[model samples]
Target: MNIALPALVVFALLLPGFIARSRIKRAERSSLDYSPFGQIVTEAVLWAGGLHLLWLALAALFFGRHVQPTLLLGLMVSDAAAQARSISNLASELSWIAAYFGSLFAFAYGAPALIRAAIIRWRLDRAGAPLSPLLRFHAAPWYYLLTGADFPPGEEPDCIVVSAIVNISGRPWIYMGILDDFFLDPEGRLDRMVLEKVMRRPLDADKQPSTQADEELARFYVVDGDYFVLRYAETVTLNVEYIKLRPAA
Candidate 1:
């Protein structure tokens, strides 16, 4: 038996699980303490096995047929038996094959997002948000930290605002704005951030003493564009404020 045939067979089965794991990680931050690749591989294998088991169950239940074990074992060592059975399966029930593959694609991309939404809706992600800790949500600490959504019902902030001091050249610049968005690198560290309704000024602008007469003097000028992009690496200091807006009467 050629080593390449078995290698290919293993890859084919694991592809969908790899994609699914990637989607899950990409959709949220991963905070694993150990090596994530090993975890991914173990998870991928389990997920692939579960999916295959379910697929086989569905095939037998609805189509009244099953993949021949001879064909499964044969696939690892050579193409002949596997190809022959696969062709017969394809010809006899192309719809089932199509549905099965389509499901793999959906499982890869859609399941993570759907699962997150379900967790949030049931208040499972925030550990029974606004109430008590029924279960803990261990994903996306940045999201939880920024929005304060995990707070009790009315106490949670409606918006999170950020004031940042960024060092530029030899001087420091100050920026104030509503948090527009934030991005994380592959290592799960903050990379950069975007702010809307931004205003900027030199940090030295506030150095002088302020009196009631000087209050009218604006210290910050409105930034010209829609968003102010700041590299987190350049940030000297950051302050976050939670703003709560009263509902309209």
Candidate 2:
């Protein structure tokens, strides 16, 4: 009985850690070349500590006191009958506690993830929002992970284009330009982006264009007259990878 209870506890503690390690492995499968030893150890320690605390809390709350330490000591030194009795009692107590608190833990982890997934789905499904083909897959959620200052609704700040990679005519092209303005459809969804004073780098480019070398391509493309209109649909992939509002000079 003592051996069984300790084994159960050990299994419970390690299950979460194992699941976490599997998820990390899946996420880093493409880019990471080396084993993440530090991350693995950190996650294992964190899961073990968190589960221990949960178990302790459940025991204290339901049983009116902590019992594992005493039970473990008894198991180690007690006689056969005494050890058997202690193990049976401890197993019975933990079974009830695990049944109740395990459900609570599952709900706590699941609810938030479901809520966030719903929110991201709603935003992406809205009409006129910039749609990416990648959004049809698991990568959709990554679109919301934009790095920028928080711009509240109905407030248009002076947004500057730092750099952009645009796929045009079945070929990838990089452009360096200044963001002038943006247009939204009737539903207040982003429709078109206008970039002014644009300079196009060479086709099939892998590296960022040198601003000094491309001085000739630097010319003002007037808004509503000659500015580049990115309609969001014409490209295979569009990433606003970086943006910084150029301060007024």
Candidate 3:
């Protein structure tokens, strides 16, 4: 049908870009709000057109398959009748077209990830590094915030110590622990954090933690769980200490 032809042409143009975007998302570890929908569509169109043009150019040079621009343009504007007339030729070369698109899809999935890996290996994602303006070590801020990736390589923290104040039972409570893991909400905000060896005490129940409190750590009771989950929304205040531990003999 006339309607289906245009749709297929659009699909043929956009599908490879979507494939590449999906791979890039994984490579970059992006959050859900990576880009606006309009920007995504615009980038997809650009990616497809550029990749197709380059592919056609290489094909002409290497395989003598000099695809005409009008061939693609005609497909975009073709009706059911025109497609029917060209059906036999298309069917004859269907396998070659399939192979060609298959290779392009593979390239789409691979090239972005390869580039990202190279950038990371060369430290090009760091601030003041080459291409740092365009490429980052990660698309998620959580990675840098939680892991201290911006720190010098050998000095990066081995652990995160978290202290949080939360009002849950009509009174504020203070909790402290080593951060084990964290989760993100659909909108890419902090959802909850998981803690190990968690300890807690009611606010105003004790003096602030310090060398003085080191003598009275018994004031804080252990949370009897392998991991404690703290919802970010319930927290009134949060503090984190990035700690680097020396190897024990």
Predicted structure 1, TM vs. truth: 0.66
Tens digit of per-residue lDDT, candidate 3, span 147-220: 56566547668889999999967988999999998887766678899999999888887655556656557778
Instruction: Rank the candidate models, highest TM-score first.
Output: 3, 1, 2
**What are the TM-scores, per candidate, against the unseen true structure?**
0.66, 0.40, 0.76
Summarize candidate 1's per-residue lDDT along 1-249 as a digit string, tens digits. Answer: 355766876887787777665554423445543446787689788767876787778778997877766655765656666666655655666686667767766776678667556655555546455433423444456667666757665566877889889887888888888897888876667788898988888889877857765462477878889888987888988888999899799
lDDT of 1 at 36: 67
lDDT of 2 by residue, 144-237 (tens): 3231222333322444553455676667665655566655454334556677766665454434454664444443222344578776444444
Residue 1, model 2: Cα distance from true site in angstroms: 11
Worst 10 residues of 1 by lDDT: 130-139
- Candidate with better lDDT, 1 vs 3: 3
Find the candidate with the highest lDDT and give its number: 3
> How many Å off is the CA of 176 in candidate 2?
5.3
User: What clash pairs does model 3 have?
Assistant: none
Give residue 18's lDDT in candidate 2 (0 to 100).
50
